[model samples]
Target: MKTELVQTFGSRFERSLIEEIADIGTWMEVPAGETLMDIGNYIRQIPLLISGVIKVLREDEDSDELLLYYLEQGETCSVTMSCCLGQSKSEIRAVTETDATIVMVPVQKMEEWMAKYKGWRSYILESYHHRLNELLHTVDNIAFKNLDERLMEYLKKKSEISEDNNIRNTHQEIAVDLHTSRVVVSRLLKRLEKMKKLQLHRNYIQILDL
Candidate 1:
């Protein structure tokens, strides 16, 4: 655990802080497709990613999910941080995009570390800044971009984050993340395939152009 913590956060976090995390934080290994967090769940801990990726999403009025952002190694969920500090329920959902390892930091220690560890404080603030920018980008994508363009961006992000151009995600899964229907996703995917932008398999997509 110490080694993983150091490998993930060594450069930015103080050694003492890293040691503290290794000692106190609960180590967890989650498989792909696992829901690490869900909307309305109590937020008592914030996860520090050690490996793999987590996609965060927000639910709409009809309970459809819209992708917010992806959290990668060494990064924590800013929304989780806010909810933890406020002692409120989680507003967004976090799911593992692939097999993942993480350290769960108890929210009870947040205040102590904020006052005691400059690195921790900076990390929290910086996470907020970064996630805020991502939220704005999501807003712009929704407001200004066409569905096809948004779909391409979504595929690009999935490919890049998982480092696999041959994405094994189902059309219905993609539709859920994009806040659309399976029929719409299937139609758009076939259109993209006709344009030679991608290859649509029985259950997966292979990126050919974009």
Candidate 2:
């Protein structure tokens, strides 16, 4: 476990911090599409991603979901940190985008490490700053971009994160993530197909223009 931690985050974090994580953190291999955290759930552990991608989402009262951003290799969710410190339920949802190997650090150790390790404190603060910028970008897309423009951005980001031009998400799934109606997504997709931006198939979409 320590070997894995060292390989993933050895240089980024201090030697002592890595040792502590290996000692206390529960290593997990979570599969794709699994919901690791959800709205209103009390977070017990903070995930330190070793490989693969985890997408963070936000939901409304009616269960409509909007894609916020992604947690990639060597990254942790700052929103999870906030919930851990506040001792409150999670405000966002975290789902595995691919088969993911992660170390689940117990929330209890956060404060101790913050005061003990200067490196740990710096890393946490940097993570918060990174996530804040992503959240702001999401807001800008919603407020400034048209629906079609937003859809393009979403499609590009999906391809980048999935590392594939062939997107497997269904129309309804895309609609949910975009916080729009399925009909709207379908209509726009058809237009994009005709424009040679993408090629649609049953249950999959082949993006021509990223």
Candidate 3:
């Protein structure tokens, strides 16, 4: 667990800080294709991803839609400030894309830590900053980026996690992330595959080139 925390947050802290959190929380495993959070759910808890990935999604009023974004290890599902400040009920839907393990921390326990641990406060502040930056980036991209560029950028980020360039993601998922139609994503992916830039297997994709 200490090793996982270091991998996520970097080794700027002594091991004791991570050990403190690990001591309290038991690991929970979530199977793929299960919904971890639904619309209008309480936000009094956050899960620390330890393995595999989860997809954060929200659907339109029609309910025949999805907004998919990959939430990998180390990313918290609950946006802490929103929940802490008593904002709207969380609209985000958290669904596991792969079998996953997460350490769930209740809000009350988090508050206690925030009050007691000076170093932990710094960690939370850093997390807030990073999350804010990411949100800003998402906003900027949606306003200015084209679908192709967004898809390419997503692939690039995914490639970093998977050294072999394997991006085991679906076109429908990519469509949601890019805010485009699945047909468009499918067409583009087919072109890329034909160019020999990637290998497409059942429910998985691997980038052979850039």
Candidate 4:
């Protein structure tokens, strides 16, 4: 648990808070494709992801799991402050991508720890601020930038496979990130492919001819 927490959040804190949380934390082992939470569920506890990745999804009124963001090991599940402070329920879903171990700290227990331990308090506060900044960056990117520029930047930053004239990113994943329809992305890809700027293949995209 200590190693997982340290690996995810970084090891700048002393051992006391980690030890304390470990004492009360309940271990949850979840299987792949499991939906941990649905929209309108009040997640009173926070899951500290110890292993594997969870997709954080949101749905439209039509109830589709439109992928919002993903949380992997070391990230906390659910942006609960919106639900915690305002709405009674969260419009979010957490789906497991692999067998995972999550340490669930009950809200009351977390509050108690925060009050009693300065280190824990500091960590939570810092984590919240960091998440807030990330949210702001996303908001700015979506609101201020053109889609093409945003797409390019997102690909450059998030694409795992990149070479001088090629990048590999999944179309479905890019559409989710771009908050656009897959058809739109497909059209754009075709245009780029026609220009000899990229090539879209099964499960992968390649940049071509620079």
lDDT at position 118, candidate 3? 71
Residue-by-residue lDDT tens digits, candidate 3, 92-128:
7788877888877666666677777676667677767
Q: How accurate is candidate 2 locally (lDDT)?
A: 0.91
Clashing pairs in 3: none
lDDT of 2 by residue, 125-206 (tens): 9999999999999999999999888887788888998889988988898898899999999999999899999999987899
- Give one digit per residue, the lDDT tens place, for model 1 in 1-210: 998888888888999999889888999999988999999999888899999999999998888899999999999998998888888899999999989999998999889999999999998899999999999999999999999989988998889987889888888899999999999999998899999999988868999885
- Residue 107's lDDT within candidate 2 is 94
Model 4 Cα lDDT, one tens digit per residue, 69-101:
556666674376446545478777788856778
Question: For model 2, where is the 10-residue window of minimal lDDT?
Answer: 4-13
Q: Each candidate's TM vs. the true structure?
A: 0.96, 0.95, 0.77, 0.73
Q: Model 1 TM-score?
A: 0.96
**Candidates in descending TM-score order:** 1, 2, 3, 4
What TM-score number comes out for model 2?
A: 0.95
* Candidate 1, pairs of clashing residues: none
Give all candidate RMSDs, comma-separated.
1.1, 1.2, 3.3, 4.2
Give the clashing residue pairs of candidate 2, or none: none
Name the runs in model 2 displaced over 4 angstroms. none
True lDDT of residue 196, candidate 1: 94
